[model samples]
Target: MTRIRLAPDDGKAINLNWRDRFVATDILRDAYVRYEESLNPSAPPFVTLDDGLELGIVHSDVPAIARAISSMLTCSLEDAKNENGGHLPSAVVERVQLEIISPWGVANLWGQTGHRFVLSRSGGGGRSEILATILVGQSRQTIFFLTGRYNNLRHSTVEEEVDFDQPAGDDPDQRWFDLFAFPEIERFKPWGYHHIANFVVAKGHRGERLSRRLLEGIIERYAKDHLDANERPIEHGQHLLCGRGFWQIGDPPWLTRMERLGFYLRWGAESFFIEKPWAPLPAVFDGDRKIGNLEYNRSFGLPERYQGPRPTVASDEHLLERLPEVIALSEDPNAKLQYFQTMFDFC
Candidate 1:
């Protein structure tokens, strides 16, 4: 029998030893329900999909829903340890745990600026079993807030003094100008940049390619110019100038998957753990053996060629040629930071 252990907080750990007969999905569903109930008793309803799964967007505007979503994200990361042979670092775990538990941190991370794409299924007794989730920030304000939040998080952790409070006078608009502070940034303002802040799939669903589906949904919805919920034209105007995100080291497979989905290393903005104080480098392990560092804090952008209504998927031949260069830059972070720092400049 293949026995699977769960996190202690998951509520299933007690019976999991004897429940080896249960399928992976069934086990995951029960654990998700228990976690959700503990986090939020009055969780909101979600849209049911044809396959019995539920798909919904948890808006930061709804505090109760946001808190529940935050809790789930933290739990999902915790669950990852089981899949990774229990090699997930404590620092990475603690950072996320702190982020969700921190005041206004959830809001700053997934609040007003963006919403999360959640896939779940009815877990019986009026609870939904979360399967996969991706957090997206749609506005420039989100970019500013995220950049500042990450910078602050890195600084605080590295200094050995962690503070989760939202910094005073940390206005997104002001922070945007403060970070960029360059004439060149103005030229690329027309391209509406969105951010993929964080994403994760449940342990049972790892090989299912749910991540790609989530990305495809975002592309179909926001890739073109569209009206907002208010029915007014979006201020940034059409063409998702670029979808931006950070790539940590050690996940080369993730890099290849993203490249196939139209994402690429934004040429000049390479960040190294040794030199860049802003990039958080958490130690990662493989079972008892210590592998390399986990995350590199490097930035990647969706290319302009894939910005239109229907993006032409990058061919395998192209990925074969480009993957090496992308891998090389990620491996060697000390590579110089270029003048055009933003994704708009590169994409």
Candidate 2:
């Protein structure tokens, strides 16, 4: 067994763990929901698919004796009767306990680390709270899963090699990772970048800079795992912090801090952008030379490729005008199913 040591046991150590499972029940499920809402009040009011994730307990292994007995019961009615005739024989079973809770199940963090990250606090009773989290992974599979559409899975890839250990030739969708690619960027090759988002800051802890600390923890963890211990001054490749620009603040202006630390803008799409090598951009591109970038902080803008009608009402007048038809469709089960995924029309 290899026992590795971590350097700098300070307040900055990342709390990475391998499949840490806490005893789960109905109570914990509700508590988790409360935990999420307390951080982001904008989350859905009730349990929808977006909020309907839960830990599933599965018996990963059954002892050979148990399997033998089960086979006997299946094959011989007489043997089954011997075990059940007003006296069902029960025996202690040995098995491996595996919990099926991933980020999606435990906290609605759709694409979370397969390995859990647990913190060791000062007091014995640690706080069971998740103030903020960032889900980092690779490629189009991340976006494909988030869109909740299965048919379009094949069309989502931007790069070929994902950062997963899945065997070659397996279904990429089932692998839970994506690769990085930017067609607009200069002859961009398949890059080993991870997507970092689903970041949330608890309502009360809003200004505490927990987000920044969490990001640092992530970098620490990443570096530690990729350490070339045999080689001095371990080197790593530059990557992307994939973020959407549709939010009110858009692409966390705090990212500018990372730019100062050697990160810079690598690509800018209509509603998304990426940073590479730690650099800054006073203004992001508008996908044109003559039109050029409109200057920094265009958080209010939508995708340039979006051809959807503009809002008629100040708040959403254009969309509101189409509500009656959407409502009518909602009245019929078939129509509702057909149009349910069309969020723009309903909104």
The models' CA-based lDDT, in order, is 0.39, 0.25
Residue-level error in angstroms, candidate 2, position 198: 0.8
lDDT of 2 by residue, 152-172 (tens): 122235333233435223554
Residue 342 C-alpha lDDT in model 2: 9
Q: Write the residue-wise lDDT of candidate 1 on 187-278 in tens digits.
A: 21223345455566655667777766665544443333332332432222122313333222113224555555556533323222232343
Best by lDDT: 1
> Which portions of model 1 miss their true places by more than 4 Å?
1-49, 61-64, 79-89, 100-104, 144-191, 221-253, 260-262, 275-347
Worst 10 residues of 1 by lDDT: 12-21
Angstrom error of the Cα, residue 84, model 1: value is 5.8
Q: Cα lDDT of model 2 overall?
A: 0.25
Give per-residue lDDT, candidate 2, residue 288: 33
